[model samples]
Target chain A: MLIFIGLGLNDEKDITQRGIEAAKKSEEIFVELYTSPMPNINIQRLEDTIGKKIRVLSREDLEEKSKTLLELARRCVVAILTPGDPMVATTHLALRLQAEQMGIKTRVIHGPSIVSAAPSFAGLHVYRFGPPTTIPHPSPSYRPTSFYNTITQNQARGLHTLLLLDVNHEKKCYMTIPQAIEQLLEIDKEKILENRILVGIARVGSNKPELR
Target chain B: MLIFIGLGLNDEKDITQRGIEAAKKSEEIFVELYTSPMPNINIQRLEDTIGKKIRVLSREDLEEKSKTLLELARRCVVAILTPGDPMVATTHLALRLQAEQMGIKTRVIHGPSIVSAAPSFAGLHVYRFGPPTTIPHPSPSYRPTSFYNTITQNQARGLHTLLLLDVNHEKKCYMTIPQAIEQLLEIDKEKILENRILVGIARVGSNKPELR
Candidate 1:
């Protein structure tokens, strides 16, 4: 059996009791950090919390050599740990499809996600959010124009956008609110528009989530 | 202090460990079910799990009679329990704004939500989803036109639509997926589309989440 356990958001304690139980019961555990960042806790912290040693997997290991994990699922309980909710990224889905194709039983232990948590934590209405857009750092060669377009369209309709700060795979960058605000302001100046209402949330799912 | 605790997608166990601790420490606990539906768990089960009795509130009660709750918050720790993530609905946002206006301190406890969970659980990519649209039962005056528009648009772009079912306040109606699918098919026929892929999920946070 393959159990995809969501480590919730932020820390090791963010995991549900059921998810913890599943992780403990599993024969082998693998933590994938490529999907989303769980910056609060480390592999050792997770291992201590769940009482199991977790082997970390990269994008290459998951996408290229996933058959070994699938084979492990056939013999024993294999738990795949992910930040926030598991399966938010397509790699997780592709793995699930591979598991299904191989006839391995699979289960997803749901966890708290920022998609829902962000709006709630920031005191924003979900219905008022048209769509969420990710704003990346402006590059000379690659400018994410579509993201700006989505923000403008949603703004015109009086909808809030969940501006996800871009992650640079090459530089190991987690874009901060200040950087995002700067980018938004730059876009506003270039496009000749005013700043819409933006909410900045940090450390969501923690006891003290900072909102500004 | 008023703490808004998201009860996540299912029973009391769906809450984070921090949320459970907050509930235990709270002097008064209240549950709001207007924004989202409770998945297969009753007040008794919740009280049993959390070891605290929770008073239930409606939209009107949370919005209109909120002074009493705020007063309780001022005196002691009060938890506003909600299904899904708190502040997903406008009512929660309004309540938060009101609390801010009255100089009442408020905190939010994040939870798993159906917004992203619907697609995540269904093995659909969250980023590919366009602006999500809700589907309501066709009425004489106000039919669910946006439902069809969103579905068709998402299909055209090879994206998925996480269609939230409508909730009837008077009858307390939680529209099931079968009903939603039928409505979609009817609307799709009018638009001359056929054989589109659709996924339906029920009681997502529960142990036995029905998926089709």
Candidate 2:
């Protein structure tokens, strides 16, 4: 059995009771933090809470060495934990499809995701928000501007947009709200966002979560 | 102090550990089921899990009589329970604003929301989903076609749309998947959805949740 569990927004206590139970019962547990990284996540504290030791997996481990995980899952209960809701990332969805093709049963245990939490924390109605977009850190040779088009399209429809900041867990680089805003401004040289209001939320699911 | 807590997608166990702690600490707990309803939710079971008596509130109770709840919140910790993520609905956002205007402190405890869960269950990428829309049970003189337009807009961008089925908790009238599909077909006489695949998710966050 292959179980995909979400670690929610931040730290240990954010996981649901069902997630905890699944973690405790799993024969092998692996966590991948590349997709979404919690600001205050402590693997040791989460291990203490679930009473299980978790092996951290790099992106390559899941992308290239998935056969090994699938082999273990085919024989025993193997749980893979992802930050926020599982399967939201296409890589996880692809992993599930691969596991099923190999005759492994799969299940997803949902958890609090920033997709919903960000708008909620910003006091924006979820229904009024358009498709969320991620602002990737631009490379010298290649800068993507599709996210800007998405925001423009949403704004044209009078809908709010949730801009998820890009993260590179391997480099310990997380995008700050100010940096994201600067990128947006650079992308929108037309000054379309000059009159727009942007809400910056930090450390969601933490006790001192801030929204501005 | 007023804290809005999300009950998550299904039963009592679906709520995060933080939600349980907030419920236990609240001097008074009120749950409004009009916005979203969980099929397998048992009030008694939830009460047992949280060790607190929950008072059920109607839409009017929150809309018109919010002063009463806000008054109690000013004196003690009051928690308003919502199915899925709190503040997704504009009514809850308005209530929170009102509370702040009256000098009441407010916070939100995030939970698993269908906005993310539905796409994940359907094996669709979350970023590929456009703004979500709701299909209400059309009344004789009040048929709304905005949701259909939203779907059309999303389709134009090669994005999937998450259509929420409307429910009337006061009448115990929850819209079924078939009913929702039929409504969509009726609203889109242009047959925009004739060739499109619609994914129906039921009993999400339950032990026997089904997706097709």
User: Cα RMSD (Å) per model?
Assistant: 3.0, 1.5
**lDDT of all the models against the reference?**
0.78, 0.88
Candidate 1 lDDT at B209 equals: 87
lDDT of 2 by residue, B1-212 (tens): 99999888887777888898889999999888788887677889889988999999999989998889899999999999998889787888999999999999999999999888888878988778888988887889999998999899889988889999988888898889999887887778888888778888888777677988
Best by TM-score: 2
Candidate 1, CAPRI quality class derived from DockQ: medium
How would you encode candidate 1's per-residue C-alpha lDDT over B91-164 as one tens digit per residue? 77788888878888888777778887888998876766766788986778977587777667656656667888
Pairs in clash, predicted candidate 1:
none
For every prediction, compared with the true complex, DockQ reads 0.58, 0.81
Q: Write the per-residue lDDT of candidate 2 for residues A23-115, one digit (tens) a residue.
A: 899999999889988767889988888888999999999999888989999999999989999978888999999999988999999999999
- Residues A106-132, candidate 1: write the lDDT tens digits: 898888887778876776666556567
